[model samples]
Target: MSLKSFGAKIFAKNIRKKIDKWASKPEATQKKVFQELIDKAKDTKFGKDHDFKNIKSYADFSKKVPVRDYEELRFYVDKMVAGEEDVLWPGKPLYYAKTSGTTSGAKYIPLTKDSMPSHINAARNAILCYIAETGNAKFVDGKMIFLQGSPEMEEKNGVKLGRLSGIVAHYVPSYLQKNRMPSWETNCIDDWETKVDAIVEETRNENMSVISGIPSWVQMYFEKLQQKTGKKVGELFPNFDLFIYGGVNYEPYRSKFENLIGRKVDSIELYPASEGFFAFQDKQTEKGMLLQLDSGMFYEFIKADEFFDENPKRLTVGEVEMGVNYVMLVSSNAGLWAYNIGDTVQFTSTNPYRVMVSGRIKHFISAFGEHVIAKEVEEAMQEATAATKARISEFTVAPQITPKNEELPYHEWFIEFEKEPEDLAKFSKTLDESLQKQNSYYFDLIEGKILQPLKISRVPENGFQQYMKSIGKLGGQNKLPRLANDRKIAEVLEKIIKA
Candidate 1:
């Protein structure tokens, strides 16, 4: 390495040392420090008329503005594209993080200079907390890998919006940024599948010490890595010590990961989105992740039981009760106020503020007009698998609308099993019973003659993962979208759904 690169490493080490000191404090202390940081945000305003001074506390601040969504930001983004100043926040939006929504295509999320720090700091906290947990502050010294979209998201106008991963790299303290495989400048907007393959090839020979990305894509990339490198990932990237992931459920994916790497990865869960990074793994044993409430944002949780047109309820951070699900609404420095991110989560405990992300509200299957959620499916599948002695690696459920000739609509599951069962039909029946038992709505729909039996397709061991790879759409921020609820998704499912 060059002298500059070597010097950068030393600088990174010192920075990490400082972060370690900050994170070594008790969780309660960190929360207080973060709250103070948030208080400063309230005091910082753009114009003389900016009304934040009237807001005395987090509860008062949240009540002043109704919860918002991605659509609200899109309106501001439109203004930014039209050359409007201070459109997204109080200042110019310095970066637009392009991310896909459930529908209406890609949303160009505006990130002002003020808001980016929240994301950067939250990520810093994640790293430092991990170090504190493991007692290893020099974690970044090893080679790192991130399975991300191609750094080439050049738009039709020739202006390049850096890939989400590239933007992170650019903002990282220069000393800590890893020596990435493909130069970010060369292929910023390359398709997701292309990025996955390129990342696999780029890291084929290198010894990666840390790996990070969405679980679905990471699973795909590892599968491809094994195929192309002709060696298991444990052999190729022998030094890999940590695997950080978020943006998807790890339960459907955990086993496949263990088999590929030949060991249990030191997994860390993170909540990162185009808007901001929200939370991270809190404790080694619990299912909860801690939120960065004090990092440039104010947070609220909507109670799952509360309703406005039957929608979930919103609760302020202070009002949160342990073990109840709530939707997240955020007010960020990026100019978004009371934005509902559409994710559902529950606090496992509140003393240290531990939470578990349940799933997306709109991303569930209820084809027979019976509301069935992803978590319900996961639970039923787990119970059925345990009872029938079948192991499922990964699975997705699609609602198959009836053809013009068909009489009814039904649910189809694309499942990859650990081992082919001797009696697939019996296994299917057991799973159906499990689903009925756990999800009464699903059971009612199935038994009362609203829907038919759930169809099962035994997918080729890695078929879905490969399909995502073949299409150049796997890894990092991109994932295997569950609950293909629309017609476009239906058509895609038609081709993939087995008889």
Candidate 2:
């Protein structure tokens, strides 16, 4: 083994011990984190506003501070952006993660020095844990590339601001910097298409062992590499083995990726957001990512069905149940207290608190009150593809409340198929049946004839790409929404619809 590989094993051993200690006593670890955050931020503007000094327990904190989304918390965030001292956290934020917001224009999530380690360590430890468990560390010596946002940043109120991925680019550890691929100039290319082409040229002849990025963008890179050199990804980089990804579930894209690589590769899933780095896949054999108990974040979950109730019960980690969809609220070291990040998740394992991102709370189809979430639609697509032996490049779901033909209103699936199914009708039926099985409201609507079985609209090849590019989002750190409540995405899709 190379020296770095050998050192990684030793480092992983130490990190695993810490992981085990916290995982074994998750509730206790969380309680400690909660206490420490309350104590440290007691004198900050937000702490004073919420009476943090007198807060003794979760109940006390909950009573003092109601759940707030980015919009509600922007009042305090604006003060911080104005260069006020200690407006939220103990001191000024180290940086701001500027993310897109629909109703609120743009959101600036604070990243304090205290919270920075959570993002960095979680990413590092995920790799280390893989090394420790699998005893395969050769990838450490070979090139690894994370297709990410540009590292270029701008200044906002004395604080550096950029996309979360871009901000994180500045923090890559010195040890692995030597093995990281795509030259600095290539990464700084603002146009994603140009960047990917540059990256293809830069890394096409190098030794690539690990590739990480959002799956869709990575797929584009893989296709470009194949075009540049007529070889499978695995053949191009025989040592390539590990694939790390976050932002979206990788299952739907797995078949296509495996085909492009010409083999299967071990993958590590991560659940991270601008608000926090919440979880990472610890075991290769496991179904979900393990929550970071000691990440200085206190988690609260409200049942998705009851989330909008006047006073929904906010359950701590100890009270969350396995397999139930919950809207996650977080109080973190970053000064976001009882903050709703808008993602819904389901706990797959309660022992060590493993979770899967089910969907976004607002990214659902409820135009007819069926309320189909992203998870449901994605799974439905999975089932349909499996049954029909169909391959898809991309897809999205939106409710068609008004039909031009005056037919029954129905869900419209805008899909770009990589390989067309022999029997498209059977594929559509399978998609509807799978969705009906998962959501009773949807099943009832179908049975009662309030909604027709979903209609499939073929999107021309590269149509989704064209749509994204048209919206000026054909680049790093952007994700396509799985489902939308209205026809906003569907109408635009119609212009490019093939059949």
Q: What are the per-model C-alpha RMSD values against the true structure?
A: 5.1, 1.2
Models 1 onward score TM values of 0.80, 0.98
Could you tally the backbone clashes for each prediction? 16, 0
Ten contiguous residues minimizing lDDT sum, candidate 2: 490-499
Clashing pairs in 2: none
lDDT of 1 by residue, 40-65 (tens): 44443321223555655555554555
- lDDT score of residue 438 within candidate 1: 69
**Per-residue CA lDDT of candidate 2, range 16-125, in tens?**
88898899999999999999999999999999999999999988998999999999999999999999988789889999999989899989999999999999999999
TM-score of 2: 0.98
In Å, residue 28's CA in model 1 sits off its true spot by 11
Full-model lDDT, candidate 2: 0.92
lDDT, each prediction:
0.66, 0.92
Model 1 alpha-carbon miss at residue 433, Å: 4.1
